[model samples]
Target: MIEEPPTTTQRSAEVERRRAGELARPLTRPAGPIAVYDTVTDGMTGWQFLRTGRWLAYTAAAILFAIICLFLANWQFDRGQQASADNAVVAANFSAEPVPIELALPTLGSYDASQNWQRVSVTGVYLANEELVVRNRSNSGTNGFEVVTPLQLSDGSVFLVDRGWVQPSPTDALNPDSIPRPTSGTVSVVVQLRPSEAPLGTGSTTGNQIQSITLPRIQQTTGGDLYTGAYGLLNSQAPAAEAGLTNTQTSMPVEDVGTHISYMVQWLFFALLGFFALGLAARKVHRELNSDDPEERERASARMRKRARKPFTDEELEDEEIDGFLPLTRWGLSSGTGTGSVAGKTVGPTAAPRVVSPAAPRMALKQDDDAGDREQGD
Candidate 1:
């Protein structure tokens, strides 16, 4: 029988076509995050992922991510609600012909949250010489500075006016002189939205020395109260074109209502995920933790502890005997003189009772014979 040639994966048309398609396609959101390998599914796709402990981790992480995603969606929704409310008030305040500048200022103390977008007008002395430009700001893929001209109101209150972004140099972002220098003079000013800033946390960077304009690093350096939120994000009408600097306005951010509700959902999801992941890890080791059959483990542990505390014994050493003095040979005694007695008398010192290993049985036999001889004599 003849067999066809085995081909490399790249050589196969189907594989090549699939790879090419994947390479050609732009990444977009799919129906679900877990559906990426749908073609590989033969009813065991889930089980395969479940086999690795990583799957449990992924599951936990996914729950956390899901909570985040949901929360963001909800938070985004809340923002939309806020924005809508603001828009309505802004519409009401804005429609009335521009009020003279001073009326807007004294009304701030009495303002309500519903009137967040209340229009403010001021007859101000412009500190145009103090043109503070926030540097390294990029808008619409073009690098520029957000020019903030500090408006000194007739009442002596200082407010920052975010004029707009301007390209200081055609290619470079660093042309302070190229920026249209504001001519310092008193002028009627109008602002619909006044925003506030948050503290920059332990930020480190070389920042533009401009006084009013705020960025994260700049906020840390100059610790000042900036805007509550970004304004003129509507880009609906241009005060600049009305004032004549000639540049395209920045595009407004999407007015999405789903963000806050989404964020809350996301946080809730995270909490749930934390629970689920801990559960899986708990499950993996549960039987061992709660086992009733623990004799072997306990015994091993006990033995180890006993061995650690054991004391030394003395059986490994030998007993030593020290000779009191020189033997007959060493004392230079003649052989005949040293036979069981010294100087034809008992030794100078009394001897200890001998433990007669060699002649013990013979000594006993002699004692028995002496007893028999006494009996016979009797």
Candidate 2:
């Protein structure tokens, strides 16, 4: 009696069984620069693997990455701390009862960071001719200049007062269109204290224009005992100026401790994540190479293989179709083979045929052969 050639269904079933068996087989050592292996199988214990050159290199890389992350986190933490300190100062001084300027600044040009935004009262005469405009000032997002006028106090001392901001001329961007003159003669002003800005050392100061509210720079022209440590943002003027410009005082510093805290936390998490990932990868390598149970070893190998496998591309699929090969479908069967019986049931072609590369099976067979040879030699 002669047996008929196995039907397409039987051939497919046999292919599947062989494929499953191949996947279930333990993997031999892979050949590559970054290949992972079982420590015990390679005649090394867990501790031995940790001491290997490759693992040490991996550990060093993780340490370097963690160090960078930690540095950034530390920088952000410092920034957050500084922001909190600034908010505290603003909260303490922004709305406090007005104090005499003499009390706030006991000596000439004496001011403290703690006194920032402190309301102060000063009686002096406004010297309009000696007024200067601070260049590159911004008011409500519009580029402008701040009008800084000298206030001569009772004791022959001078205090700089930033009256307000005025827009530059429409034609000439460098100069103000018109500076609203401060209240002429003696006036009592209520203002918020602010640190004197440093000289910019750039920009043309030819006319009554200066790059910053630097007292030393302004003292050269005014010639008197000047308050060099700090100036004031005009809050209100007794017998207010006939015409006033837009106030240039900045809004209160926000109390919120922004995203720095969150970012710092995230960086810390990332540092830990890097170590966790390395440990997980090491554990997977140990199971794949050192596990005594063949099934466990096979499963680990299968998982690694699946992760390493690249998905088929459209161009590759087209090339297979051009080569006249039946492409494998999702069900691991030939597509569009026309009325083929599947598991004792006739099925219609629903998709175009796809090609199944022979390279994978060939590689599996080669690995198995190599393992057998190694075992025999042992």
Candidate 2 lDDT score at position 319: 61
Off by over 4 Å in 2: 1-47, 280-298, 301-378
lDDT of 1 at 305: 38
**TM-scores, one per candidate:** 0.38, 0.69
Pairs with steric clashes in candidate 2: 327-354, 327-355, 328-354
Instruction: Give lDDT tens digits, candidate 2, residues 1-378.
Output: 556755657545544544322223222322111334544347653445777788888899999989999999999899899889988999989888899998999887799988989999999998898888888887778898888888999999999998988898999997898777777778999999988887786755768888888777677767889998889999888897767488876577675677889889999999998899889977766654455555654454344344324466777556644553323332232233222222333334332222234324333334444775799789
The sequence of per-residue lDDT tens digits that candidate 1 reaches over residues 238-277 is: 2322342333343222344455556656666666667676
Evaluated with lDDT, which candidate comes out highest?
A: 2
What overall lDDT goes with each candidate model? 0.43, 0.70
